[model samples]
Target: MRGGPYLLLLVAGTLGVGRGLDGQLGSPCHPSGRCNVRFSECQDNICRCSGTGVPSAYNNRCLPVADGLKGYCEENVQCTVPHSHCRRFSKECECVEGYVMARDRSVCLPVSRLGEPCLERAQCKESTECSPSLGVCVCRGISYEYDGKCVTDHISNNWELTVVTVSPAAGSQLLAHNRWLLCIALAALVHAGVR
Candidate 1:
């Protein structure tokens, strides 16, 4: 009977001592990045970060970039460019010149998806591809190379590059269009040294 009491006391003491040492009672430091308001615990069962880009912590846990956005990022695998938000249409994260993050985490989406049609190579879906381009899935081609293999280029001209630039007027909307023409014009002026 004395042995049973001693065993119970020992167990209770051990538990009490652990509670004192940890000081949380049961709430430990939750991972910042790992928690999305749904699950806040890092210990028992939590989703681990796994993405090609650099791992980042939000709540307390490290998070990897989301899938389908593999090599289009520089820092946070989810982002194509630094500080840029991931585009759902292209699956590439790019920062538009003027847009900022909204309360719902929505980023600025340009008309590029509507103007230029790209499917398969650039990760653009078939139905989403723009017209006249007859955007169709094809083998990875020219502009971008994946895994030592060059992805296919649906656009025939390399002169076509979509760049988002802020308009001159104050509070003017940003435009996503061909930057090649501007570069060429600038180059011509530079060569001629126009005033």
Candidate 2:
């Protein structure tokens, strides 16, 4: 009876040690078992999965790393698309600024210039508008019409005019006119290197 109790205790200790070793040697994944990429682990003798990093559609199965633009990704390193970035919130790759997602969502393309076809505002360059009715980008509002394009009037022309409106409560017509004359005089002085 003394030997039997000792053997039982020994067996229990060996089983505890075996379980500890399993924890150290067991893989989070198992062969022939499906799991979301790096997002799941085997737990409690079952393939337990979570949805935190895995999309709902892929939560039930293992999915290969995406290879193109706008593809699902866990990190930027996994995205193979050119000029793209991984958005953690959406778990997908997206194009950087000055670029647009292609129609197929497989690549990033340079933004359309003036008069080019555009499907969205992001498809056009800055200070340009995508005309929904015309199906092309156009520059409007104080922009100069150039050779089949639009350019900033003030910047490209190298000059700008500032209009100052005087409030009627602050000044009479004559006073406003005097303020304009003073502004013109100051501008002339600066132009002639007199200031």
Candidate 3:
């Protein structure tokens, strides 16, 4: 049999497929369809996809949903359950990093990322935890909050927090400079009074 002429995209939870020797989704086919594959087959003269079967978006073949299978969770989480990610060559429910299942475990939420409200540490983003007192995510231990991100004292990656330090010598010089300016101002005032 020859390859069909259409490409198909299998979406979440839906059997989206159709292909025949020359039959594409919604195309005409004979009662005794010439081609058959796991994802699709001749049915009522129409090609169709069934559970877990996907048709090639680039070819006229039936394939399985691989990692490209999108994770169905809020905040781009890539899993169905909390604190997990998608596995390889297969579709799996996963939550995005820095997210966790809700208190009811009904869904995932982005509790990671500082400043987000969180019920528990598992929900907060990496290196952060939910503050029981403040009731929001904050940096853990030595890390601190900066620019909406949790970072170490020596943070890098173009987000470094600059710390200003002055030695005793620098402090004395600044004080001397201020004193000289004050003396100069007083001298000017005396000169004006004399005039």
RMSD of each: 20.2, 13.8, 15.8
- Give the per-residue lDDT digits (tens) of candidate 1, residues 96-172: 55433322334333323322434323333322332334663332222343343333332333333344565586223
Task: List ranges where model 3 is wrong by over 4 Å.
Answer: 1-26, 30-39, 66-111, 117-126, 130-136, 142-195
lDDT tens string, model 3, 1-195?
A: 233322222242123223354444444445565335456756686666556555554335555443322443222223324455554454454555555656655566775558878777777766888899998888999888777777764323433233458799986786687988656555555544522
Clashes per candidate, residues 3 or more apart or on different chains:
16, 0, 9
Report the number of backbone clashes for model 1: 16
lDDT of 2 by residue, 1-195 (tens): 779999998987655441222332232444344333345555553444343332224334334456677677776655657888788799888888778887788778778988888887768875677888998888866675576677654332544445678688655765665887777757755654554
Q: Give the lDDT of residue 177 in candidate 1.
A: 56
Off by over 4 Å in 1: 1-27, 30-62, 66-77, 99-195
Single out the weakest 10-residue window by summed lDDT for candidate 2: 18-27
| Candidate 3, pairs of clashing residues | 77-96, 78-94, 79-93, 79-94, 79-95, 80-93, 80-94, 112-124, 112-125
- Give the residue spans of candidate 2 off by over 4 A: 1-73, 77-83, 87-92, 101-110, 152-195
Best by lDDT: 2
